[model samples]
Target: MAVQANFENIASYLQQFSHDRSIPPLEKWNPDYCGEMDLVIKANGEWWHEGRPIRRQKMVDLFAKILWKEQDDYFLKTPVEKIKIQVEDAPLLISAVDQVEIDGKQYLQMTTQNQDVFVIDAEHPIYMRAFDGEMRPYVKVRYELEALVQRNVFYHLVNYGELYDEPNCTCLKLHSGDAQFTLCM
Candidate 1:
């Protein structure tokens, strides 16, 4: 199938980047934009190149690490080059979640497809958006990139929510690492 072939190609290409947990300092890189590429990350988290789907999970993981956003545009950046790419929605997807309590404070952590861990705290707040025709949740990742919190994960997150009344509206607030977030209004 074309999908499988694309995956193989992607896997080979990913070896160029090497698998490292540390994200490259893309913000510090001042590379010139080398025009647009035929790469696209679908809303469902599928990566495509030249209109073909990249089915390899490893390749997707590699690309996720180097992804960045400026203003409203998305790009794949490295120390030497920057290539513009298209993202149908959030650049990353929160595929799993874990919660822990530290000193009576609750901390919520999310794991992305590439195994990047992020704490849902003041520095990384969660937001909800209406996409297509339904409400989808998102969380700030590094720099200007955001990860879409998956449906099942959202359901799990609601278990810790508490209702809070404000001057104009009542919202479901949740806590993670001593940081409180408004889940819904």
Candidate 2:
């Protein structure tokens, strides 16, 4: 049975929430930023890649797939997936995001809070109307983007389009207008 909740005035409320919310600025960005990636070295002690370091656009595509390869299990670390939000009835899947790792070490971050101030369910309506900066919920997903947000290493939606061009891995549009994802090469 579907209950009719009055979401008639929710869109305006959501807009205010989006406009006031903020996150730390990305230090740098990569169009092809993949986390904890491995680069092979030759017997001759020369630097080498599994394949030649591809063109920038190609690298971005590859990075997205690598992260999404084990989408569910990857986030198993902090376990951010258990979510019930006011956004939709379906539970949101929050994944662990390891920004980048080099020499077997990388930085990792997990999603914490993803709330929807719309439709008014579990909070005070007065609180909903309240616009205090301190009380606003950081409702979007946050990844440990140790890599710069403006780099060309991965397919950054800020610069390029989707992260896959060959073999067709699974791709996803992230919460950010300038961010998207893919799974497996």
Candidate 3:
């Protein structure tokens, strides 16, 4: 199928699943690879198509819902088709962070650029990885997909972290609910 026709079909087919905030069951979807799309998610969290930035927030949000990852590649999947896309860094970006208390327990909540919110816990723990020669923080969003914690959000999160002295090195420890993450280990 041509790229434009396929793109419109995918968008229209996915519209039904976009009404609510729940994510589509991409894991259960087994579609044939429909070649590649000229879609590139840049390291800075901008979605570009062809050579121009995709300025439509709604379209970006809809596409984010269908994002799937296999091995090291990313794809936009529908019920019948899957198109590979390029990702310079992590597919999503953690745009904001907040510390919320519930029943006297603290939890770190992260919001992605697409407005997907998740708590930092065992299910979505933050980890350090080397990106562009610097160790940066990332949190798992869902289905093996991760969001690169923005630098400003990372700094804001640091305020809620405490210093811990490991046996070999000192690390920054962040506690959220029952999960504890040690950074710079």
Number of the top candidate by lDDT? 3
The lDDT ranking, best first, is 3, 1, 2
TM-score of the candidate numbered 3?
A: 0.92
Give per-residue CA lDDT, model 2, range 37-73, as digits (tens): 2232222212223445423432322222222112222
Worst 10 residues of 3 by lDDT: 163-172
Cα shift from native, residue 75, model 3 (Å): 0.6
Model 3 misplacement above 4 A: 164-170
lDDT of 3 by residue, 24-142 (tens): 89999999999988899999999998889999988899999999999999999988999999999999999999999978899999999999998999989999998899888899999
What are the lDDT figures for the candidates, one per model?
0.79, 0.24, 0.91
Q: Candidate 1: deviation at residue 172, Å?
A: 2.9
Better of 1 and 3 by TM-score: 3
Predicted candidate 3, C-alpha RMSD: 1.9
**Candidate 3, 174: how far from true, in Å?**
0.2
Please list the residue runs of candidate 1 whose C-alpha ends up more than 4 Å from where it truly belongs after superposition.
1-17, 102-104, 163-171
Q: Give candidate 1's TM-score.
A: 0.84
Backbone clashes in model 2: 21
Question: Which candidate wins on TM-score?
Answer: 3
Residue-wise C-alpha lDDT for candidate 1, range 58-170, written one tens digit per residue: 77788787788999999877665567889998888898888887787779988988788978887789987788887778999898888998888877777777777888765
